[model samples]
Target: MRDPAQDPDESGFGFPAPLWRAVARRRPLGLDVRWRSPLRGPWLTSVLGLVLLVVLPVVTVTGLLSYSAYGPQFDQAYPGDVGFLRLPDFDWPTDPPWLYRLNQGLHVGLGLVVIPVVLAKLWSVIPKLFQWPPARSLAQVLERISLLMLVGGLLFEIVTGVLNIQYDYVFGFSFYTAHYYGAWVFMAGFLVHVPLKLATMVRSLRGTSLREVMRTGRDQTRPETGPSHGLIPTDPDPPTLSRRGALGLVGGGSLLVLVLTAGQTVGGVSRYAAVLMPRGRQPAGTFPVNKTAEAAGISREAVESWRLTLTGGAVEVSLTREQLLALPQHTATLPIACVEGWSTTQTWTGVRLRDLARLAGVTEPSSARVESIQESGLFRAATLQGNQVDHADSMLALRVNGGDLPLDHGYPARIMVPAIPGVHCTKWVGTIDFEAG
Candidate 1:
C-alpha cells in the first residue's frame, strides 16, 4: 500500500505523470513500444566518447587545413575577398603539389569514419535527454546547453559536409560559411564537454575491465536494473548486443563506408573500388564538373567572343585567343583538387601568368585578382597570392591534354595554378587585376 505521491506511476519516476504519458504515447516509426530499447548506462557511452575523443580532433584539424589550403589567408588584404572569414594574409605552401590532395582526402575519409562513431555515441546518451528533472542546478543547466551545442554542431557539420562532397545544396545558406562557423561552435562545445566528462571517463574506464564488462553486459558503476524499468515499457529481455559486438559493428560499418567512398579522392586502384563515388570515370581531357556550362548560362558564342583582360598598376592588356596563343606557351601536368573530395590530373598548356603580369608592366605584384565570365556565383572571382603567381607551373591554361579547353573545363582560358584549390583556379578567365599593395 503506497501513498499516491510516492507511487512510481503517479510520480513518473521523478518526472511528472503527464510528461511520461506524452512521451509514451508518441509513436516513433510505429514500432512496438515494448520492443523499443530503454537501455541507458555509462559503459557504452564512455567507450563511444573515447573513440570520438580520438577521431574528432583529427577530422576537425584536417578539415581546417583543407579550408586553409584554399587561400583563406588572402581575405585580410581584400575584405570579403574569400567566403566567410576575414582571415589573415597567409599563403598555403605550394612546394608539395600533392599536399592539398592528401589533406582533402584525409578530411573526407576521416569524416566518413566519424559517422558510425557519432551515431553510437548519440544513441548511448539519448536517454539522458529525457531524464527526469532536466536540470538539477546551474551547472547542470550549462552542461545541457553545451550538450545541445555539441550534438547540433556535430550533426550540422557532418550532414553539410556529406552534402557538399555529393554536390548537393538543399539549404539556402552558403555551405562554406555555415560549415566553417559551425566547426568553431562545435569545437567550443567539445572543449567544454571534454573536461567535464574526463574525470568520469577516466574513473569508469579504470574501474571496469572492458572484457569483463562486455561479458557481464553491465556498467560496473551503475546499478543493474531490469530492461523494463524506463520510458517505454519492455519485456524482461537479455542484452541484444554485447559491448564488444557493438564496437565491432561500428568499426566494420565505418570501414565499409571508408572503402566505398575514399577512392574518389585517393585515386589509384582504389578508384575502381569506390562504388559510392558520385562522379564516375570522366572522359579524356575532361573531368567531372559540378556546374555545367549550360547550367551556368554561358552560350558557345559568348565563350568564343571572350578575351582575357589584364589590368592594375601601369598594365591594361586584353588578349584574344590568337594573341594568347602567340605568347610563350608552357605545359604542366597538375591535379585539380576540388574541396568536394574529387581530383583529376590533366596536362594544361598556356602562357605563364607572370608573363601576362610582365606584359601588363607590373613586375612582382603582391596579389592578382582573377575574374571569370560566368555571370554570377560565389566563386566567379578569386585572388591569387604572389607565391601562386610566381609558381613556375601557374599559367592561363588555354588547352587541356593537348586539346582545346572544353566548355565545362573553363573554355578559352582558365587560371590553372599549381597546389591551389580547384575553385580558386577560376574558370573562363576574363580579367586579371594585379594588385601591387
Candidate 2:
C-alpha cells in the first residue's frame, strides 16, 4: 500500500493494497512496535554485529580455502551438485604439509565458535523482521530478501555442518553438497549485508564505550536515542537484565563454545576437553581411524582377497599384500587430518607414490585415481592431481609406525599425501590408475 502520509493521492497499483492495509492496521502481535523488550536496541545489535564483522570473514575465507584445498580444478573435490559454480581454476599448493590441517581446523573451529554471536545478533534485531509495512520501497524489498538469505542460509549451513561434525545425518542429504552450496548462498547475502549495515553499526557504536556499558545497570539501561531502525521499542518494559549482563551472557556462551570445540582443532591434551567433538573424544595415537573397516563395510574376507592393481600405458601389475610389502619401503612422518576437525601425525612406512607410478611405467602421469575396496561412499575413490601424485612424500602406505597397517587403518594399503584432505587419501587401497590429464 502506498503510504498516504507520504503520497496522499498515489495508488499501490497491481498490488494487494487492501490486504496490506489490513496487516498494517492491525499488525501481528510480534510485529507490534510496542514490544516490551528493554534490551532490544541498535546498540546491542551493533555490538554483536561488530563481533561478527571481525570474525565471519575469517570463517568464510577459510571455508572457501578448505574447499579449494580439495583441488576442484583437478575435479578431485567432493561432488558438489552443480559443476558450473566451482571455484576458479588453480593448482593447489603442496608444501607446508600442514596447509590443509590449518585451513580446515580454522574453518570448522571458527564456524562453531561464532555461533553464539550469530544467535545473539539475530535475537537483537529480530524485531526488524516483522515490520508492519514489510517493505517501504523497492530497495528495502531487495534488502529484506537478502536478509532472508543471510539468516536462512547461515542457519542451514550451521545446522548441517554441526550435524555432520556429530556424524548425524537425519536430513538425508549429502552434507558436502548441501554445505558447499549453502556457503555460496550465505556469502551472497553476507556480501550484500555488510555494506548496507557497516555505516549503521559504526554510527550505533560511536559514543558507546565498553566502560560505559559495564558500569550501566538495569536502572540505566535504555535504547540509544535517535533513529530506531525498527529495533528500539516504542514501549520498553523495565529491564529484566542489565546491558552488561546481556553482553556477558552472549560473550560467555561464545567463549564456552570456543573452549569445547577449539580443543578438537588444537588436539593433544586439550582434545580430552572436546567431549562434544567425536574425533576428539578418543586420542588418535599412531593409528587414528575416522571410519573403521567394519563401518566402511570392509570385512576380513574382503582384505584377505585384496590385491593392489597398478595400471598405466602398457603396464598393469597386480600385487598381493606381500608383493607391496616386498617392494622397497620408506617411512615419512605426516599428519592425517579430517574435515571433522580431528588430526594425528605419525610415522608411515610405505611405497612412495612416485615409485609406484614408475612401477606402472607411468612417469609424468597427469593424474592418479586411487580406488578403495569399500563397497560404498564417496571416499571409495579419489583422483590426485599431478602435483599430489609427484610429491615425494605422497605414498601408498602398507605399514604405519613399523607395523602392518591396522585393519581399521586401511590394512593392506592406503594413499597418504602430505597436504591432501584425509578423505582423499583413499583408504583400503585396491587400485591405482594413472591418467594423462
Candidate 3:
C-alpha cells in the first residue's frame, strides 16, 4: 500500500491523493465476508435500499392521507387524558391505542429493515472511487451539498425514529410530529439521490466488469496497473470474503429481531388499546343537545339557536339556526389515528354530510370545503369530496360517545371524516364553500 505521508507528485488532476490506500488499510480486521456471494451481496443490498427508500415512504403518505380525513371520530371515542390513549401526542402513538400500536409497529419494523440495508449499500459502493461528471460547476456543488444533506437527514430520522420506539428521550419536539415533518426533508434529499444514483449506474454500465477486475488481482490488492476501462474496482483491500455470506446472517437476524420486538410492543399495548376501544353503540334521541342544559348559567334556548354559515369563493348560504339544526343527522363509531401515533375509537353522532350537501343543492362532494371557528380563530380547511361526504362513516358530528360534544372537542358541530387526520375534520364548524375545481 502507498504511504500517504510520502508526498507523491500530483497526477494530471493535481489531486492524486493516497486517501484510498489509507482507507483500505483501515478496513476492520477479521470482519468475516468470505462466505458471502459476490453477486448476491450487492444485488440484495441494492434491492433492500430501494425498498426502504421508496416503498416505505409511499405507505406513510397513504396513512397520512387517511389521517387528514377522519381523525375526530377516533379522538372522541378515546379521550387521550384518560389513560394509555394519552401517551403518544399527535405524532408518535399517544391518543387512540389501536392506531398508535399499528403505527409504532410499522415505524420500528421499517427502521430495523432499513438500518442494515443502508449500511450494506454504503459498504458496497464507497470504494468505487468514481464521480459523475458535473452538468455544470454549480451542479457539482449542489451534488456535494445534497450528499451531505442525505447523510444528515438519514441519520437524524433513523436515530430519532429508533429512540421514539424505545420511548426514550423525546428531545423536546413530539416524536411523530418530528417524523411527519422530517419526511419532507428526507423526501427532498431522496429526489436528489435518484439522479446521482442514475449517473453512477450509467457510469457502471460503461465501466469494466467486476469479475475481470477480481481475476486480475491478489483477491484484494490494487494492481499498479488497473483493470480495463469498462470495469470499476471490486475489492481495494485484502480480498475479504464476498458480501454474500454476511448478508444471510444480517438479514435473518434483523428479521428475527423485528418479529420479536413487534410482538412484544403489541402485546404490551393491547390491554391499553382494549380500554380505548369503541363501545359500538350509536347515538340516540335529541342530537346536538344544548350544553347549557347540563349547566344552568348558560342560556339553553339561545345557544341552541346558534347557526353555522358558509360564505367564500361563490354562493353564500345563510341558513337560520333552526334550519341548520333540522338537517338530517347520522352517527358512527370509528378510530382516530393522530400523527403522534396514538389512536382511539368512539361513537360519533352528526348529520350525514351527504344529506346536508343534498339539502344545499350540492351535487358533488368536491365542491365544498369546510372550516371551523375556534377561540383562536385558527380555521383549518379541508377539501371534502362527494364520495368522502357520502361515505357510510362520514358525518357532521355534534355529539361524542353518545353525549353532548365537549367545548374542548368542537362542540355545536364538527365534521367527522373517516380515515382522515383530525386537523381536516374542522371543529366548531361555521362555514362551507363550494369551489369550481
Candidate 4:
C-alpha cells in the first residue's frame, strides 16, 4: 500500500482534493506546512483556555470599575466621558478607600500575567489560520468569524492598555473610547467562542495525562477516527519540549512579568520588587504624582493668587488660603489611586468640602464642581457627587503626610473625596461650584 502522506488526494479528508494536491505540489514560503506537534493541539489549547477563562473576567470587571470610577453619574455632564454605557449614578464604594487601589492593581497585574498564556494559546492552534478550504460549512464560517473577533479584540485591548500605561499614544483614535468599546467587543467574542469550543476542550483535556500527552506526541485517537486526526501526517517529529516544560516556561514568564510590574500597584514588598515599573519608584513626597504642577503649567504667581471660589443656589464665596486654613480644619488618610494602576495613601489635612458648602451658605450641597487652576486638561475639573461631598472624609486637602502639600501633590489645595479615582480628585483646585439640589 502507498503511504498516505505522499498521496494528497487520498489524505485530503474534508478539504477539497484539488486544493490539497495543489498545496502539496507547491512549496511557497512554507505556508502550507502544518503543525503536527502534540504541543500545538487541543490539549494545550484547553490548558491555555482554562487559564484565560479565569483571568479575562477579572480584567473585564476591574476595567468596568475603573471606568465607573470616572463618575458614571456625571456621564452626560462631561463632554469627554468615554463610557458608552451610561450606567446610573454609582459611586465606587469608598469606606475602605483602598478599594479602587486593590481593584486596579489586580487589573494591571492580571493583565500582564495573561500575556504568556494568550500567546501560548495562539501558538497552539495557529495551523487553523491556514487550514485548507477555510470554511467547510456555515457553522465553520461562524466559528472563524467569532475567532477572528476574539483574537483581534484581545490584541487591540492589550496593546492599547499597555500603551496607556506607558502614556504612549500611537493611534489617532481616543484610547479611552477604543479601549472601552473594544472590551465589550472582546467579551462578546469570548462569550461566543467559549461555548463553541467547550466540547472539544473537555474532550482534549480528558483525553490524556500530562506525561502521556508529551510522550505520545499525538492524540490518543486513531487517524481514521476524525478529519482532525487525519490532518496530522504520519511523519512524527521529535519533541523539542515536554508538556510540563512548556507550561512551566509560560507560567514562570508570566509570574516574572507580574513580579516586575505589579509593584506600581501592589504596595509593600511587591512595590519594591516591581523594579520594571514604568513609573519608576514612587517619588519622595506625600505620594507619587502622575502629573506635576510644572508639567501642568501652573505658575507660582497663580498659586499665590489662588483662592477657593464657591457658588451655587443662593451662595457665593471666595476665600483666600488663610481664610480656608481658618475654616474648621479636618484631616483624613486617603489613598490616591490613579487609573494607570498606582496608588499610595496620604494623611490629607484641609477644610471639609461640606463645611465649605455651608460656609458658602448651603447647609447641604447636592453636588460640587471642583475646578483646577491648570486652565486646561481632561481632569482639570471634576464633579463631586452628593454622596462623595457628604462623606465624612471628603475635604479640600492642603497639607499631606503632616507637611505642606508638595507642588506635584496638588499644592495649595486639591479635592480629596473618598472612594473616587485619583483623576477625579481634582488637583490645583481653585473653585467649588456646588450644584443646586
Give the candidate number with the greatest lDDT.
2
The digit string of per-residue lDDT tens for model 4 on 234-287 reads 454656766666788899989888878877876666678877676547676445
Off by over 4 Å in 3: 1-146, 156-307, 310-327, 339-347, 358-366, 377-383, 390-393, 400-408, 433-437
Candidate lDDT (C-alpha), each: 0.74, 0.80, 0.50, 0.75
Model 1 agreement with the true structure over 173-224: per-residue lDDT tens digits: 8787788878878988998888777765665566557877556543322332
Overall local distance difference test of candidate 3: 0.50
Poorest stretch of ten by lDDT in candidate 2: 1-10
Cα TM-score per model: 0.79, 0.88, 0.48, 0.86
Mark the 10 consecutive residues where model 4 has the least summed lDDT.
Answer: 218-227
Give the worst 10-residue stretch by lDDT in candidate 1.
224-233
RMSD of each: 6.8, 3.8, 12.5, 5.5
Candidate 1 lDDT at 71 equals: 65
Per-residue lDDT for 76 in model 4? Answer: 24
Segments of candidate 1 deviating more than 4 angstroms: 1-41, 71-89, 208-236, 281-285, 313-315
Q: How well is each residue in 181-247 modelled by candidate 2, as lDDT tens digits?
A: 8888888999898887877778778857878989999788886676567788888888888999999
Whole-model lDDT, candidate 4?
0.75
Ranked candidates, highest lDDT first:
2, 4, 1, 3
Name the best candidate (by TM-score).
Answer: 2
Q: Which has the higher lDDT value, candidate number 1 or candidate number 3?
A: 1
